[model samples]
Every structure is written in structure tokens, then in C-alpha cells.
Target: MKPALKHFFDSMGAYFGRPGEESLEQLYAEHPGWDAQRGRVAVYGDFVRGHVRGVLEKIFPLVRGAVGPEAWSALVEGYTLTRPARHHELNHLAESFPAFVADAAASRGLAAFVPALARFEWTDFAVFASEERAPERVERLTANPTLAVLEHPFQLCAYVRTKGARAEPEAGEELALLWRHPELLVTYYVEATPSALLVLKMAVEGLAVPEVAAATGMPEAELRGAVERYSRDGLVLAPGGGHG
Candidate 1:
């Protein structure tokens, strides 16, 4: 590209990468050589920022509600300025948002559980949108392709169900399993027992029920029963006769 054209595009990039009049003024001061149409350019910048904020709000509505209006506004603006969306599709834009939220949580006075909540919400959306499919049958126990094991310090399942009415999560250590419903094509989560999580985890690690029983010192029949129960819910993909 010619120097003049390259400079113009570079200046516009700096301006559009951040929202607010302050960023615009900085751009003008830094790029005095270029005289782009300020008003027309500002409109486009505003649209990009607005669209990014709107998509994030839709994806993390509970996070917005928990933070309240003023904080939520600042949060989205800060996120846009720091991590501009780069994906061709906006659906993947918030892929790093949970980590971003975790980094900002303490400084923003957000509750301890907020980061985990964000992760759970993202996982829920991801699993629902995933193209992966569970196999029709397996010779042995197998973990569902869409299974997600979530462990956090809050009762996030109930909190999400309340739609932020339960803004403050009840304090507790919780482990939950989330997955896409094979037939229903929706996300579902259930509080997991240690045995249930262990069974699935072992299956994912390519261990059969007998191996898990031997390693954990549990009876093989008991472990097999657990696998059969989970198979009924499609959490475990067992053989043809194993699925209830």
C-alpha cells in the first residue's frame, strides 16, 4: 500500500479500536497529516462498539444483571477497548470473556462466584452449539462427547435458573455436569455426585467400569450400575443393551 493510504487506514484503526470522544481526539492529534471525514468515521466506530456490546450482553445477560447497569456499561466498554472482536462470526467473540471477567473481578468488586458463573454460561452455549455427536453404541462405557464437568465454589445451577434474581450465589462447593441433550438439542445440567463424576471422568480417560472399580476400591457391580443409570440419561454411552 502507498504510504498515504496506509497511514489513513492505520489512523482509522486506532480511532475505531476504542470508543468515546477521547479516543477520537487522540487519533486526530496523532495523525494530523490525514484529514478523513470525522463524522462519517465516528458513526461507523459507534456502530462497531455498539454491536460488540449488544452481542456480549446477549451472551452474558446474567453477568450484566449481576453487575448492574453502570458497572455493566463500563465493563463492556473496557472489554471492547481491550479485546476487540476479531472473529468473522460474532458468536465466537466472547470466547475469552470468562478469563477477562476473572481478571477484572477483584478490581470491579464483583462477587467471587462471577467468573465461574461466566464460564458456566459460556460452556452452556458452546455445548448447545457444538457440531459433535455421541456415538450410537459402544462396546464399553463411554463419556458423552458433549459432557462438561464444572466445579465451582457457588451454586451456579440455581443461580442461572433464577435469571439473576439470585444475584448473590449461595456459598458452597459444587460439582455439576453439563451436556447437550442428544434428542432435545438443548443444554442440561445436574448436580453431580462424586461417584457419578468419577465414573464419567474415568470413561473419558478410557477406563472401563471394572478398571475404575479396581482403582477406586469400589465393587465392579456398583460401578456398573452407576454407568447404566447415567447411560439412561445419555451421560454415558454404553453398549446397545446397556442404554435404558
Candidate 2:
């Protein structure tokens, strides 16, 4: 009920499991050495922390799984404290984790292959809920929509590619194409080239061959070739074809 205690609880709730400090007192009263000043500290929250921690843990499981328990806990501590998500929806919350990996991989340091592996896994669920991919392909690619459906807001995601035909980490910012299909399947793949990435992107965004070709400075025949490549890869599909 008190502000200091309330503040402590809300902070705890962010990391723990409660609506506020009052809840913390009620829930964690039996814990060792619990007091007014240290109502619910980081360690306490970790014991009770749920959704966000669970999601991040899944993302970095390979990193964690490879390292085992003690080391993984330490890694998780770094991620939860440093890269907290404010959004209520946990499924698509790892949008920032890729960027966080970039920072940690550079500064705090991560297990080798972590940055690439994390980026690949991070965007897996997001493509479905993302705004970039159009919902229900246009019956007529050229005609205007009568109901005025808005193309979804896009999510910027990254992917990894093998170097020299092996799982070599990208030396720099890797070019990737991530988009949701009508079936809500989020797919990721390494872009062969910048042009290839851009062309594939345009294809997934529901751009027609001509528009994409004009925008990308490729010949229609070439664009068709690229679209077919995307189709072969199962990244994009024919208009009248089934969604997803």
C-alpha cells in the first residue's frame, strides 16, 4: 500500500509475478530474509519470472543448451536484465532480441555462434503477426481494394548465411528476407545477394513481377526468374494458390 513498497512491488511484478508490491508481500512473505527495503530483488523475480524469461530462454536455448545449467543461468541473467521487453504480447516480443544479440555479441560477448543462431530463431514467430506481409492476396493485383485493407506494418528481421558452403557466421550485417505467409508461417533464409534479397522481399510483400522488376532495375524475364526461385524455395507463391 505504501509508495516505496508499491514501487518495489511493481518493479518486482515486472520481473516477478504480481500486480504490485502488495502482491509481492502476500506471495513472497515466506521467502528468506524478506524485508521492506529489499522487497523483491532481481534474484527473487527470477525464481518466479514467467513469460518473458521463458521466451528468451527458448530463443537462446541452443546457447544455453550447449553451455549447460550454471553458465546458462548467468547468460539468462544478462539477457533478462539488459533486454527487458515492455510489450504485453510475449509471442512476438523477441523483435528486439536480435539487436540485443548484436550489442551483446559486440560488448558483453556471447557464446560463439550465438549471435547468428539467436537472430535466426528470434524472428521465427514474428513473421506471422507482422504487418509487412499482406493478408489475403489481392484477387486482382492491379485493381484497387473496395474495402481499403491496409498492408500490415512490417517487422525488420535478420538472418544468417553459410560462407563457402558451410555454417560460417556472417562477417557483417547479414542480409535476410523474413515475411509472414497467408498460413502465418514465418520463414527465414540467407540471401544469396543484395539483389536476391531485395527481389525476394518484394515478392513476399505481394509485389507483382512488373512492379518489383521496375523498382529493382531488373528485366521482367529476370524478375520472373527470381520469383520462380522464391517459389521453388517455398518463400512466395502463385496468387491463386493457397495461402501459407
Candidate 3:
């Protein structure tokens, strides 16, 4: 009835379940209330949470697979509590949960791999959630890891691979990609450090095989082979990418 009460109830919807139908009617004197049905005050409420959880389940399958069911639910609950998604799209709802894993790792730092692993998974997701891709010179073949040559906003999706003497992937950490357009896809491409550079080349710098190989220290033959593999997979494409 009043703005204050309405606001309070709205906040309650987010925190508690929707006001119980009884409480809803009793408080607002409405004929009926959402409480009678389900009460998930999530940003997406019930169905959306299911959608997001499904997304998370798919994207973080290894996380679920590794952590197991009970632990997976705990991770999801903790994620929901600490980080309420701000994104309007259910597609991107799990965006920052990787950081959540990183934070959790702070205590034990034991499962350090979980951080990059989670983030790697998120990349594929961002690619799929983002709008259509622009033309890149997809019609070329090279081992250039950087030549992935995507357009901005779609470029590497804000994650980059780190290298050099100072940068080394810990045993637990992994590099991954997340993508979902026509279908949801997440991949864990295990490769030697140099091979991993091939992935970084395409994802981070958008370089084609030759260009990527030139930039990276990996041998030309190896780089070329890697690019061939990636390009064939649709992960790496002709220079003119995503555009008709």
C-alpha cells in the first residue's frame, strides 16, 4: 500500500522467498500473492536461476565434476550470496563467479588451479553471449596464435594469457575457453606451454598462424600444425571472421 512497505517487501523478495501468499495478502491486502507459488528472489528469480544454474553446470562441469554434487551446490550458494549478478542477461549471469573461486582459493590457495580453470571456462561463455562477430581475414592458414583476429568487444573477451619467465601455469591451473551461441561449449585444451601459446595467440592477439608464430617462440612447423588444428575446429577461422 505504501512506498516504504512495498520497498520492504521487494527487498524481502530478494532476501527471503516472496512473501508467503498468506503474508502477502495479510500485509498488502492483495487478492492473491506470488508467495502461493514459488518464491525465489534471485535476480532471475526461479526459472532464471534454473537457467543460470544450468549454464553454470555446463560451463563449470569440471568444477562440478571435480568438486562433486554437494560441494557444487555449496559453491553455487556461496556465489549467489557473495556476488549477485548485475548483468541483465541470464547468459552472462555467472560472469564473475570465477573471481569468487579465486577468492575462495585465497584461504587454502590449495586448489589454485580452480581460479584460472574457472576463468578459462568463462571465456567461451563470453564469446557466445556477445553479439555477432565482424569480418576478419578468416580465409588464411597460419600457426599464428594471435591471428585469431577477432573484432573488439569480441576480442579475447577481456581475458588474456600470460607468458614470459615470470608467468607460469601452476600445476592445478588450466587454460580453457567458454562459448555458447547455437550451442553451449566449454573446452579444456591441455597442451605444452608452447602449445598453449598458440591458443593465447588467437584469443589474446588475434594473430594468424604465421604472425602468431613470429610473435611466439614456438617453431614454425609446430605453430602451423596447431593453427591448422584450431582453424579446422571453428575456434580459429579465416581472417574475415563472423561476417558475411
Q: Model 2 misses residue 114 by how many Å?
A: 3.1
Model 3 stretches with alpha carbons more than 4 Å out = 1-13, 16-49, 83-86, 106-110, 132-244
The residue ranges of model 2 lying beyond 4 angstroms of the native Cα positions read 1-6, 10-47, 65-70, 82-87, 92-96, 106-113, 131-133, 139-173, 192-223, 231-238, 242-244
Put down candidate 2 lDDT per residue, 5-123, tens digits, no spaces. 87654555444433345654555454445554554454455444555668777655554554457655665555566535556777545567666665766555455556555655655
Greater-lDDT candidate between 1 and 3? 1
TM-score of 2: 0.54
Lowest lDDT sum, 10 consecutive residues, model 3, at 146-155
Q: What's the alpha carbon RMSD for model 2? A: 8.4
lDDT (Cα, tens digit) per residue for candidate 3, span 96-145: 77888878766633244456656655664555445544334545432323
- TM-score of every model? 0.78, 0.54, 0.52
lDDT of candidate 1 over 116-153, digit per residue (tens):
98898888889888888877667767778898889999
Candidates' C-alpha lDDT: 0.80, 0.51, 0.50
Compute the lDDT for candidate 2.
0.51
For candidate 3, give the lDDT: 0.50
Model 1: colliding residue pairs: none
